[model samples]
Target: MKQTSFTEDQLTDALRALKADTSDERFRLLTSEPPKARIRPLLWYGVAASVAMLIVAASIWQSSWSIHPDTTPTATTATVDENLSQLVGQSIAAQTQAQQQRTLTNDIVSEHLSLVEP
Candidate 1:
């Protein structure tokens, strides 16, 4: 087995070499300026997107309101009431017909059973 250790002088020399390889001036130059030219286009794109969204929202709002113009609620209510009453009358007539059919079926079934029993 072998154990390796760095002495203080060797560690100091390695650190000095590493520090000499890195440049502080390059880092300062990279970070000094805000990227204004790139930022302006992105800002304009965002503004254009918001305006487009507003226009779309306004159109949707206008179309929805325009589709159903202002009319008296009573007229719509009366039409709905007439339709509902017709539906109810048809439903009642169908139920009565079904009841009559059931009664006729019951009578026929009872007559056949009686004849079979006799």
Candidate 2:
């Protein structure tokens, strides 16, 4: 004979036993505690304050900003020429300094090597 897992009667009996022993005790205990009241006044007050703040902020921003015509030259020919001359001068100075540094470094190395030999 093949041994089968829990028979239908056994399963039904176990379920019935569990149902009989279980109670709504925990649910009753939780519900017995006082329910928290919703504060509608505070919510309305916050919304009103936010709307008032936005109105004040918008008025201030509108008062501060104004549309005006451009006054000064954005890209004058003389200004561009001046900028170019300044950049060229800076580049020439940088190159001259770099060359001087290289010559000085080479001289120092040669002097040190000569001292170390014979």
Question: Which candidate number has the best TM-score?
Answer: 2
Clashing pairs in 1: none
Determine the backbone clash count of candidate 2. 0
Each model's lDDT: 0.84, 0.78
Best by lDDT: 1
Q: Candidate 1: where is the Cα deviation over 4 Å?
A: 1-75
Cα lDDT tens digits for candidate 2, 1-118? 3336778997787677775323588678666745433467668889999999999998976654533234243657798899999999999999999999999999999999999999
Error of 1 at 52 (Å): 24
lDDT of 1 at 43: 97
| Clash statistics: count for each candidate | 0, 0
